[model samples]
Target: MTSIASTSQAPPLVLTVAGSDSGGGAGIQADLKTMLALGVHGMSVVAAVTAQNSLGVQGYWELPPEAVRAQLDSVLSDIGVHAIKTGMLASTVLVETVAEALAGCDAPVVVDPVGVSKHGDALLAPEAVDAVRSALLPVATVVTPNLFEVEQLTGVKVVDETGMREAAEAVLALGPRWALIKGGHLPGEPADLLSDGEREYRFTAPRHDNRHTHGTGCTLASAIASHLAMGDDVPAAAEKAKEYVTGAIAAGFPLGAGIGPVDHGWRQRA
Candidate 1:
């Protein structure tokens, strides 16, 4: 047999700046898993460490701002990311630090604005909300906020799909290039609205009755970042991410004694 040279190119690089989920379901774990499933290389800069499981979060400790900045610098200065996703920035300082770091990067940024966990445990500090709104969101290429997160960030309570446009508009006022309002908490079919303050796109998917959707937010944001790294436009990335998460939610399996996680590798199983 003759020797052959390899011609495979390197995969797109995505970086997640978030907390560490001990349960391997959310935060950094979920981000990396979603990136891998989407055919992208994933890197992480953990901003906090959580004592979390399927049941709930017991406690979490935010990393020092210096450490978080160092990790971000180390990654961006050398490895360089094609897209960046942020979640669970527990404090104002960390949020500002990350925002400052990302302001200089040329890559697309996805902000998940995680305020609480699936079990209602607070993941972000009460004071950090201001920083996220003022600093972090301004630099975001796209901001993904669930209903509860929408209220936290913009005080827009979405009772039904009708209110999603208001929610997206409110988030867009904060300065992100685009806002994606996730209406998964509403009754009936799950729908998400993506808007750039000018054009709007709505994505709807059949609702899955499974309760094992612990990492849906993180997974969705990471998937969007992965698609952006792969060169998809914001609207295209959101559409693909919505499709991916819907399948993952449908394939969600129970874990531990409480809610489980969406299957990141659901596509492989199908």
Candidate 2:
């Protein structure tokens, strides 16, 4: 152990710009947990604060645009993240502010268009949808949207695997380098569709019956960011993230008499 510090390497830095979940299930908490489990240094810019638990989101208050911008500038200017993941932007102003901050960064950006929680509680405002489409998504390296969020952002309702491509196309038209349409909400198998404007890829995993998937979206997006920070391309990153989330979903466990979070440290537990 004489000079082990000289041989040690620092982990890649990944940043999450999201809301805070008081119950430690979703948002910034889940993002950091996923990043940690995936071997990355995680940083956070909390855009909003939520009074939430396993049941549902009670109320959330968005940080002022200036405060959000200050936090973003502090991290991005000094630490210089390798990748950025976004979630739960509660208002149009915060979304716009975050979009501007991300536009200046050279790192890969993972945008999780979080529209609702696992319990069907709304996380994003209706007015912020356009801001996300016009400002946030355009700057994204990969946009991850669940079925309902896909419909919310792109107006493409994916009822089956056949509709996933359409949904990906709609999101691609918004200008992200890639779009990942998450099919976890669809019945039967859990599938995710990823696409650039020209090529398409589909990842399917056996559906798990566990209901404690409260943080899947946040976890998946953070995992993608972590992979990207570790030098994987967008398609490769999404594929790996899909694999990790599938395992986490299978390992989900109940908490507080309601839905619980996916186990971010499932690999260690296994």
Candidate 3:
């Protein structure tokens, strides 16, 4: 007789190495929620913890480098991941440690350069920015950065859509196979650019008139990693992720007092 565990089919496993958002809107919480909604098995390595709510991030604490390493080892040793997404490694040590651990992993990696929170609170330390650019970005399969982060990492401010190409070029120089520049901050239609230094793919969606998109970045990056785990190429994975996030943004509802989050369970609830 086949055991239940053996007979039951398991979904592709995607791992997220990120900070813990006590608010449950972004970071590891959002990543896992996005992965689950996209029909993937989600695992996590908590790199930091944030005392955050809808209003803003009040305080954050970084887990020690050794603790972060232990968590990564425990997950990778027994149940290997098909893909990885990283977010909000708060300190230089954490970033370097995560980068080193991921260096041995062969799965596709999505690096969400989370610099600030939805309410303009800093997530990653100012000094750690260099570590993310020099260490994490180089080993990423795709680096997803919004306009602020693009400027933070590359010193190139994206004032409009035309600056996206330059931002992608700057990010590609950091050694990632693909660079996904999120153009949601622009005034017109929301668009994202996925580039591999040789070719580019553009995904556009009608801008939803919603202000509760707190976790959109984390959600999008995790969705891409989830699709990559399911065997989609970088371009297809990004497009599907964008579609999923657009719907989520459309369905986003009010949470606490300030900005809410994208609805990860929009499909089931809709």
Candidate 4:
């Protein structure tokens, strides 16, 4: 009998399609860091580039649609991402390209409908909002949006905790099987409302009294993707991700003259 060689397998791959933050506070940097911290292999596709920092974004330029599509194919064809997370697709073409590519990929997708940076800079174009709704969101396994994003997508104002239901309902209507409306932007305790159209779950956390919460959204979405790659269910992944982001916020640090990014490595340091 001839002996055969054993092949070593690679870890599960998670891909993030987003912008580049020069400051490394949010966007691609935050996504990769969060994925790594959660013990998942992370990949990237640059959709846009921005001169950004703690203060704000100075300028931005989106990549050509063909380039974006090519990058997606290059990765999905070879490395085979286990989960996909998207953020800051600045134009309608890029959004459409991602949607078309991911529509057939069999994997959980965590969609962070990022409309703005942490410092209130406009990252998404008005024309692209429609694309995000019609193209990307429908294919999302879990759509994670904060108060502003909820309003942008659904035309609903999230004034308080009670409004999370309406926001989630509207988000589910956009075709995502699950919607996680982050309530951290709401007053009172830090909590999030998740709905699968049939069921709803509340993830509560003690609000950290820290201003260093720049990358919380990106971190949460990446964490959820990581857990999904590790085989956690939607509800479990969302809950665990919320807990992780809370801890990260609690341990957040100020890096520049303005609000800073959350500490993605808080758990390791502890």
The top-ranked prediction according to lDDT is 1
Q: After superposition, how far is residue 243 of candidate 3 from its true place, in Å?
A: 0.2
Model 4 stretches astray by more than 4 angstroms: 1-8
Candidate 3, residues 1-270: lDDT per residue as tens digits? 876556777899999999999988899999999999999999999999999999999999999999999999999999999999999999999999999999999999999999999899999889999999899998999999999999999999998999999999999998899999999999899889999989999999999889999999999999999999999999999999999999999999899999999899999898
Residue 76 alpha-carbon offset, candidate 1, angstroms: 0.6
Winner on TM-score between 3 and 4 is 3
- What lDDT, from 0 to 1, does candidate 2 have? 0.92
- Model 2, 1-270: lDDT tens digits are 475447777799999999999988899999999999999999999999999988888899989999999999999888899999999999999999999989989999999999888888888889999999999999999999989988997778888888998898999999999998888778888888899978888899998888889999999999999999999988888889989999998998888978998988899999
lDDT of each: 0.96, 0.92, 0.94, 0.92
Give, for candidate 3, the lowest lDDT window spanning 10 residues: 1-10
TM-score of 3: 0.97
**lDDT tens digits, residues 11-122, model 4?**
7789999999998978999999998888889999999999988889999999998988889999999889889999989988889999999999999999999999888889
- After superposition, candidate 2 runs with Cα above 4 Å error: 1-7
Indicate the residue-level lDDT of 170 in model 3.
Answer: 97
If ranked by TM-score, best first, what sequence of candidates would result? 3, 1, 2, 4
